[model samples]
Target: MNYAIAYVVYNPTVEQIERINEISFGHPVYVYDNSETISELPYNKDIVLVRNGRNDGIAVGLNILLETASGDGRSHIITMDQDSLIDDHFIKKLISLAGVDDREIIVAPMHHTGDITYDKDLVGKSSQKLYVLTTMTSGNLLNVQFAIDVGKFEEKYFIDYVDHEFCLRANRKGYKVVISKDLKMEHSLGHSEQKFSLLSLEFVPTFHAPVRRIYMTRNRSDVWRKYFAIYPRWVLRDFMRFNKELLGIVVFEDNKLIKVYSIVAGFYLFIMNRWGKAELRYLVNGAKK
Candidate 1:
């Protein structure tokens, strides 16, 4: 069975990608470069670089790769972030564990080497029978068919919770998202930093994005709206729990506009039945200006 390692990048350091290529030598590297133009990627033939006309978000970029992987007849598509150090044995382990009939989405463990101390409870435990939710696309090996089936990461989400949303959808479809405790990788989280006013929100060593404060703020409501349509009370309870925590995080600590924008987005998501569309329109306007 063929497998491809795919990455989505925007104005990322060429050296870092090159280093990843060095680690995963002899495999086909598919990179969707969403920057202004596809800059020079590291390798030659094995590397396929798809350039978007402008800077699209990571979710859209990964969807491009998901399309490629599904069509190419590859059994597994390893989705990774540009700014991560993948384990040398990641591909080998995933390929070994992958069962065509098993219906599993694999997520590998990630360690943060930055300021936050490692917490076993947070990143260590699995949910129900499923794998623990760690970071994003960095350490994930997904069945290409599963991705294609679930519509390949909601582009409406743009970036934030795209992975979580994908995982949630996969679980709803009866696919078990499992984490391999053995495979180890380290991530330089929030490599995509944004400047809000003069004070830039420094990179947190996890999935935190200020610009994606829009996506993060809005898309979870999409999760609630869409998912709760099927499982009502349970998803509603979960939504309240998640939004309450998210409210504190954004309102108390984040940038004023981003915070207010999140509030507006989240409120509309709950009341207007728009879920994520309202925020998408807001982003479209922001992109225009």
Candidate 2:
């Protein structure tokens, strides 16, 4: 299957530009950059930038990249985030994973959030063959037609839980979503705190900003409602993890009042069947911050 490299960026920085440059391949790198102001990204032959001067959402940018690449006759696309760093070896592994039994799969690397330091004893589990219920958007070598068949992205999500919803839908249809146990990628989840470093792996708590907490809570609730019956293990595990983060915010993090309120507003919106682009300036009670 023919493959292409693509990533989406918003308000990219110099370091991010350098990171994107590191992933360049034989093909022209496709970029869906929705930087708020027109960015200073190069308009060279090696890069194809799709700067529409809007922050519609991550989902819109990703779908545009996927459709554009597929329309250009590519069989697979390795969608990545601008902040993610990769090398020749990582690209080769993704290419190889795409050739692993053509039975519709979205192969992703083991995401190592930049903050946690894994112990040496955790090395052998790299080959554990992890077939997860969902994987993140970054570090994925997604099959083009398979994604389109799964009904493209759920644009209503806009940002959070988009990948989870897509992966769950595909999993229900007997399609595979495998995270590469051997390959590791430098990915940032949130403000991470090392929880533990043993038990064959590690755990890190991601403390997101209050605004992000709202999107995550809302989208998580929406996706949970959509797929809880088909994937209770995933739903239950993730719910506990989310509550853990919430508890952390209440006890440790700042902006306690607003963050907790954001979660409540998010859940309230979900119950009220309201969706798309969350209002960022006020609470559910119409009080401005």
Model 1: ten consecutive residues of lowest lDDT: 192-201
Model 2 C-alpha lDDT per residue in residues 68-88, reported as the tens digit of each score: 988889888888887787777
Give lDDT for model 2: 0.74
Per-prediction TM-score: 0.71, 0.86
Return the clash pairs for model 1, or none.
none
Candidate 1 residues lying further than 4 Å off, grouped into runs, are: 38-43, 110-135, 188-209, 229-258, 265-289
TM-score of 2: 0.86
Candidate 2 lDDT score at position 10: 79
- Give each model's whole-structure lDDT: 0.62, 0.74
How many steric clashes between backbone atoms does each model show? 0, 0
